[model samples]
Target: MTNPCDCDIRLIRIDEVIEITGLSRAAVYRMIQKGEFPRQVRLSVRSSAWVLQEVREWAFSRVSPTGLVD
Candidate 1:
């Protein structure tokens, strides 16, 4: 078996998510509520993060080769 470090498992905060996806905070939460975005993980009482790879995949999946939503 391979160690986790060998894989691309990483957690990203909301700010990074916003930067990567170009989605507003409100829009992200809205998509999550609508079952459209990657799910978040509760890290503490009032903080959360998303699986970096998941978000990357979701972002890529939403856009077509021409950079338009498919």
Candidate 2:
């Protein structure tokens, strides 16, 4: 049997987020400041991360449907 703990969600770091969203450091921080992005959960005083699924959803929400471009 597999350990139940193995199902725990993984936390992604800022660098991974940047890679996933293809945004610069400044741009991501700007979105967060504007309340347009998912907030990061603090792991420690020196560390923070975002839920992988939440980030993915945020990105997906910004996608334009085909033929809907202005």
Candidate 3:
């Protein structure tokens, strides 16, 4: 069984998110702008990344048996 704690839970870079979600950078940003996706946290003057837990939870919501998106 997959350990819940072992689920990706690190702030991931845009490229890594793209790799995981198979979405273009533009698309991801667009989703963020629309408040339809998890937003990234600023890590530096220009670097930013999203919480792996939040992203995984979001994805989980979409595929979960329940209709809830939380």
Candidate 4:
């Protein structure tokens, strides 16, 4: 098995998700509460982060079926 240190994982804060998705803080949190979005993993009692690839995949899934990139 590969060493854990060799794994690639991009961890990001909530603010970064807002910047990447252009969604307001309330909207993001609401989606999280509803379990409609990728939830942040708790890193500490007061801190959390999300997987960057999960965010990217979620964004890709939002693509319109009409084949237009928006």
Candidate 5:
């Protein structure tokens, strides 16, 4: 058993990821290939999704203390 409040795990598809990160489809895959981004979870043979929290964290990590990209 797991506690719902213990984790707010969510799965988001590529389109949502693009919208959240403001990156193109190719850019997302490219970053994943280069190990610069979080990899997607294999939901099935033909479907995949990323952890929403992980993606959000990745976006947040890109910001500098000056509140801008450095």
Candidate 6:
């Protein structure tokens, strides 16, 4: 298995993801349903989170060369 510290695989909850991506919770879920966003990792029966890097990359991917979301 990979070391969490070495890989920087931090998991972020919904609230932090919303703050980072500037997307509403509903939008996030909707995008996820359409396969436009990264899916969350199930931590337990009632908890899930997104990979911080994946979320960041997805947000970055939405940006165009003109520095706007496409």
* Backbone clash count for every predicted candidate, in the order shown: 0, 0, 0, 0, 0, 0
lDDT of each: 0.93, 0.87, 0.84, 0.88, 0.97, 0.95
For model 6, how does the per-residue alpha-carbon lDDT over 8-57 read when each residue is reduced to its tens digit? Answer: 68899999999999999999999999999999999999999999999999
Winning model by lDDT: 5
Looking at model 2, the pairs that clash are: none
Candidate 3 residue lDDT tens string, 1-70: 6767776557899998887777899999999999999999999999999998787776776764676544
Where model 4 places Cα greater than 4 Å from the true spot, the runs are 1-7, 65-70
Ranking by lDDT: 5, 6, 1, 4, 2, 3
| Model 4 weakest lDDT span, ten residues long | 1-10
**For candidate 1, lDDT tens digit of each residue in 1-70?**
6776787668999999999999999999999999999989999999999999999999899889999897
Off by over 4 Å in 5: 1-5
Clashing pairs in 4: none
List runs of model 1 lying over 4 Å from the truth: 1-6
RMSD (Cα, Å) for all candidates, in order, is 2.6, 3.9, 6.6, 3.0, 1.8, 2.0
TM-score per candidate, in order?
0.82, 0.79, 0.72, 0.81, 0.91, 0.89
**Candidate 6 wrongly placed segments (more than 4 Å):** 4-6
* TM-score for predicted model 3 compared with the true structure: 0.72
State residue 25's C-alpha deviation in candidate 4, in Å.
Answer: 0.9
Worst 10 residues of 2 by lDDT: 61-70
> Per-residue error at 49 for model 5, in Å?
0.1
**What is residue 22's positional error in candidate 4, in angstroms?**
0.7
> Candidate 2: lDDT over CA atoms?
0.87
